[model samples]
Target: QQQVKQSPQSLIVQKGGISIINCAYENTAFDYFPWYQQFPGKGPALLIAIRPDVSEKKEGRFTISFNKSAKQFSLHIMDSQPGDSATYFCAAPYNQGGKLIFGQGTELSVKP
Candidate 1:
């Protein structure tokens, strides 16, 4: 089955701490890996994504780690703040970008 599985259904972090979410998949058809962040009343937006051949990517306080051999990827938020509280999801596009499969979201609460 084409599926993406994510862990830590909910997380609580203190301000300036690190928040991490992990995801694993079995399908090889997923050529791209992306992480999205969504607020309570907003749509999930692309937060950070990694290229197929890249091992890791870092952008500001966000980072995506890809392990091709293990079929896993993770998102890390460094120095996380209260404003970073949101539901996060990892996704992969299949069917040649025609469709996307998402993981069970991780609801993050950044405590002040």
Candidate 2:
């Protein structure tokens, strides 16, 4: 199993709203999980992540809720804001090559 698929292609959330995006994977062997955030014309940056050994992980305004049994994971952005508008991506590596298999892309728009 080595595939991760994400949805919503795009999202729009109002300021102070909660923005949620879901992802599914096929690889059970994957041990590392990471969610990346990117701005226009920029490379993806690590936002948050969780390991298979853990159920969930949170960092600052970002959180990653993982389900090992369901082979699913999600990213949650708390108190959405206009500055939070950007593309989010979920990814996993095949075998620690520093290469990540990413979701198609999700363009998030946070309105003021």
Candidate 3:
């Protein structure tokens, strides 16, 4: 399997609340998991990431909770804010070239 599926296409969360999203993949060969954050009209940048070797990873207000056995992973945004509104994509490299296969894309809106 060469696909990663994500849900909630869009989400709205109040400031200081937690924003959550979920994703799953079928390919077991995939390694080097990564999550990207993008603002309108901008290229996605690496937000946070975790490999199969770890169950969780966190950075600032962002966190990635992964479940290797279930072949799923999720992103959790703590202390959500209006500035946090943006699109997020979960991805993985299919090979060494750094080519990434991404999730459908989730638009998160943190209300003030």
Give the winner by lDDT.
Answer: 1
Model 3: how far residue 33 lies from native, Å? 1.5
lDDT of 2 by residue, 1-112 (tens): 4678998899999999999999988874456778888998999988888987778788888888988778888999999989999999998776655777888778999999
Comparison by TM-score, 1 against 2, better one: 1
Error of 1 at 90 (Å): 0.3
Candidate 3: segments with Cα more than 4 A from true spot:
none
For model 1 the local lDDT of residue 32 reads 84
lDDT of each: 0.92, 0.85, 0.88
Model 2 global lDDT (CA atoms, 0 to 1): 0.85
Per-residue lDDT for 89 in model 1? 95
Worst ten-residue run, lDDT, model 2? 92-101
User: Model 1: how large is the Cα RMSD against the reference?
Assistant: 1.1
> Which portions of model 2 miss their true places by more than 4 Å?
96-98
Question: Residue 68: error of model 3 in Å?
Answer: 0.5
**Using lDDT as the measure, what is the rank order of every candidate, best first?**
1, 3, 2
RMSD of each: 1.1, 1.6, 1.4
Candidate 1 regions exceeding 4 Å error are: none
Give candidate 3's total backbone clashes: 0
**Which is the better candidate, 2 or 3, if ranked by TM-score?**
3
